[model samples]
Target chain A: MKQFLHSGFVRLAIVVVMAYVIVSLCGLREHVSILSGVDESGTMHLVFGLIYILSYAASLVLAPALFLAAIIETTLSKVNVLSRKGQEGRRLGCSELRERQRLRAPEHAP
Target chain B: MKSRLCISAIALILAIAIWLPLLHLFFRPDIGDLGLEKGVSRIADQLAAHHLQIWTNPDLRNRELAQMRQLNPEWDFMSRTFLVMALASIALRDESRIPQCLETIDLVIENTLLIEQEDGFQDFLLGYGYADNWKVQPPKSIFVDGEISLMIGARRMVADRADYQHLMAERIGNMVAQMTLSPVLSAESYPDECWVFCNTIALAAIRLGDVLDHSNHSEFLREWVETAKLHLVEPQSGLLISAYAVDGTPLPNGPGPEGTSIWMACHMLQVVDGAFAQDQYQRAKAQLGRSLLGFGYSREWPRAFAGVMDIDSGPIVPFVEASASASGLALLGAAGFSDKKYLRQLMTSLNIAGFPTRKNGTLCYQASNPVGDAVLLYALVQGPLWEKAK
Candidate 1:
């Protein structure tokens, strides 16, 4: 499950799905309120309902794109090149910087 | 558990995709039954739901007004014009609310005329006003004259304060004379050039004149049509041009509905000439109006032409082809001719997207201009004023 979550493809799909849920719920909540007579058009429930449905339908068309985004995000991270390239540049670390400074300070003190 | 979670997630997403648009259906107003009754209409109720904010709150009104003016000052001006006219029509529609509506309308008119007379009509000009002479002489605009005249007429039609009647007459007379003296029954906002839209402005004046019994002005109205046939009519669309040279000569291009002028033209035509008004309304409807999923909106241009967004169309929405200017002015067409079908859809479109608020018996649309809402209000109450006056 953790591995699945870490997969970029699943991550992308999740993001899309999450957005879809949030917007739909927000729109639905507004519709529910209006339907309950929080607005002037006490009977305009039908109109708001259609708008919500159309928006929901439009969101579904993005499913394939979500799948593709997931694949790409995962694929882009795993491409590999040689260990030889790693030796071409000096690998520095916090300990290496401290060691070099200590050596220089002691030599200067002597 | 994972499968159930996945299933629910998919279901939830699908549910939203299907439902948000359905919300529009819920707000869809009945087209036939929304008749502007002796009391406030469901449509007026929808409009006022938004408009009440303008009167009740200063900061909110100014902020919204500023945002629209950033795009089109004419909107700022037309918003007032439309709201004042709408309130007047509402007064006639509902005698009980006349006092409250009157106070708001009076405030709007007071602000409008004061600004125009104080800053000169040039105050409403786009940044382009000083960039080039958009008009002839020092600087004059027939569009401003016509709107102000209608605003004054609308005010007087309701309240009958002594001064507005005279103001209406004087303004109407100037527009009539302006139409007469132009070589082709058209007046210019620029040097000797004429616009069908401006002619429509003049038509509004002519209609006001009709109410006032300037039967003599019939010839003026006739000449305007004949001249438009000769010069302004686009061969392909048969729709009028956005502008032209004064003497029956077509300008280089065809009509553009991205401004207040064209919609106002359609409305003014209804008042000045009945058949012509009907023709204009149908042409405009074909060119711009659309209904989808029971909601109605209008495009800034017909399919035959493509144009960019401007001050009038206000932040064009994609795919559905709705323009702020076209949709707002569309109220005139829907109301002027009593096209119940269009009015029904127009109301639905407005309620869903125009963000209406109703408070303490006043209505307003937040995303709409004062003028645009007023036009909607006018649409609701239009019939008798034109009828009683005629």
Candidate 2:
């Protein structure tokens, strides 16, 4: 679980979601009216507007992307692990068969 | 681990490939059911509800006006005009709402007039408007006169008002006198500066006035069109120049064939001269309109003209040169001309970037101010008013 959480995709998804939530909670959305040339209260308003816009873009585009990437990464990792285990089991079974054949051969040789 | 990294990278690429194409869908509005032909659209209703709320709540309306005035006083005035025009259209479509719409309209008109009376027309103009003396004495801005006339004319079209009738006549008479003084038959929005947008709007108001009051201004309207074709047109683009001097010389720094001016000018010209208006709309669409990846936007200026960003153009997006003001007004142009394909694309763009917010049955765009919202509302409900005027 720690390994999964440490994945880049998972970390990115968390960052995007948290940034959007924080911006929204800060009530910065209204400052976005700066885009239309209104709400020129001060430099801080412009900063707020730009920040809100960035967070909005991230929420809409990046968050979904990261979510999908995290899912795909997890699924790929799981598939890789399952396939590796299958290959190991097949190799073990082959070796056991060889050992049994050797034992049988010695008995037949007498 | 290297293989895992490659897989992760591929997964991210695949996810983006799957998502980017589908992102716009989530924001796409139902254009088919917007009821462009008849009835109020859902968007129109929601936007109007918010405007109506602002009008009813003094505190909210004052705050909005203050914020807009801080940036540009013109927006505060234009917002009133657009909201009144939109409400009038709504009243015409849905008769049940006529009383509500009229009540708000009256309040807005009265307040606007009161301010103009107390502070002069400069109340709505930018600071630069006070710099030069208007060539015509007892300075009156056709910007104020024209839009105010349209507001009153819109109200009377729905239901006649004796008071507004007199006010409309006075405004139209003043506009005609001022326009006739200029060789180009255009009045100034600012001292010695004529805007095609303002002049076209004045013409529209004149047409609306003639229809409501049995006044005759056909000859004047025709002559104005002829003059515009002769002098106001930008030779390069064969579209109307945005600003020129009263004597028919293009301003040294004025923009030629700007989307912010041409689109709305085309819309207003519809009732004034349909064929000319249609020609201009087509020219603007070809020169200024752009669609990329299913999103529609308009350039502030044609490629030949390299116009600088101004208050009217709002912000110009780099590379694409999409003007916020132009794109917003482009909605009106597309709807007025019944260009469904372009309208859909523009609306798609609007939905994606417009940052629409709905609260308590009221809708507003977070990225848009009062004027922007009012303009959007007008675009959605524009047909009925123009049809009636025609």
Candidate 3:
């Protein structure tokens, strides 16, 4: 779980989601009317609006994408590890069979 | 670790590749069901509910109007006009809502007239509107006069109002007299500055007035169109210029063939001269309309005459040059002309970027203000009113 959290994709996804939640909770969505040239409050409002919109777009598109990518990466790596283990197990089984055949040959040599 | 990093990078790229292309699908509305032809669309209904609530609740309406008036007083006035027009269209579409729509329309008209009476016409104009003396005497803004006229005329179209008859006639008369003073037969929305947007709207109002009162303004309307074609059109694009002088010469430094003005101009012109309006719509569409990957938008100016952004254009998206205001009005133009494919694409873009919000059975776009939402509503429910006027 700690290693999973260490993944760059997962960390970025967490950041995006956290930022979006903070922006949403701050009620900055109302400031987004600035895009339509409706807000005249000040640069502060514009800044807030831009932040809110960026966070929103990130949350909607980027966060999901990052999470999906992380999940896929984890799944692929897991499959790789399992396949390697399977190959090692098969190799060990073959060596054991060879050793058993060697023992049987010695016994049949007489 | 390195392999995991590479896998993550590739996975990220692949995920983006899959997601970006599919994003619009989630926001894509079924265009056919939007009621572009007849009946009230679901979107229209929800948008109307929001506006209707605003009108009924004075506190809410005041807050919205105050927010708009801070940026541009014109938006406040235009919001009322667009809302009234939308309500009238909705009323026409759904017979059962006639009473509710008429009540709201009357409320809007009454409030507008009261403001105009108390504060004067400049109440609805920008601060620069007072900078230069109006060329016409008694200092009336056709921007104010024309839109108010259209609002009244639209209301009367749904059902006759004896009180508004004289009001409509007076507005039409003022507009006609003032417009005739210009070489292009246009009136100024600002001092010495005539807008195609305002004049076309006034012409539409006059046409509607003629239909309602049996007044004859056909010759004047025809002459205006001819003059516009001869003097007001941008040669490069063959679309109408956005602003000009009272003498009908296009302002050298002014906007040329702007989407913000042309789309609504085409719509208003539909009632005056169908062929000319159709030509303008096609030309405007060819010049200003743009779509990419199923998302549609409009540029404020054509490529040959890429103008600076202004209040009318709203914010222009860099490189692509998408004007928020123009795109909103383009919806009206596309829907009015029944350009289904463009309309669908535009709606897709709208649904994605407009950030539609719904609460208590009402819908409004978080990215839009009262005027923008009203414009969207008018776009959705535009056809029946225009058809009735015709």
DockQ: which is higher, 1 or 3? Answer: 3
Q: Per-residue lDDT for A1-110 in model 2, tens only?
A: 66567879878888988998999999988888777666667899999989999998988888888778877888888898899899999999999999999989978995
Compute the DockQ of candidate 2. Answer: 0.47
Instruction: Decide which is better by DockQ, 1 or 2.
Output: 2
DockQ of each: 0.02, 0.47, 0.49
| Candidate 2 runs further than 4 Å off | A1-7, A42-45, A69-110, B1-10, B32-35
In model 3, the clashing pairs are none
By DockQ, who's the top model here? 3
Question: Candidate order by DockQ, highest to lowest?
Answer: 3, 2, 1
Of the true interface contacts, the fraction found in model 1 is 0.00
> What is the per-residue lDDT of model 3 for residues B299-328, given as tens digits with 9 covering 90 to 100?
888888868777788778898889888999
Off by over 4 Å in 1: A1-110, B1-24, B31-33, B36-38, B49-53, B56-61, B131-138, B190-194, B213-215, B247-263, B357-366
Model 3 lDDT tens row, A25-80: 99888888777666577998899989998998998799989877877778787888
**Model 2, C-alpha of B107: deviation from truth (Å):** 1.5
Error of 3 at B259 (Å): 1.5
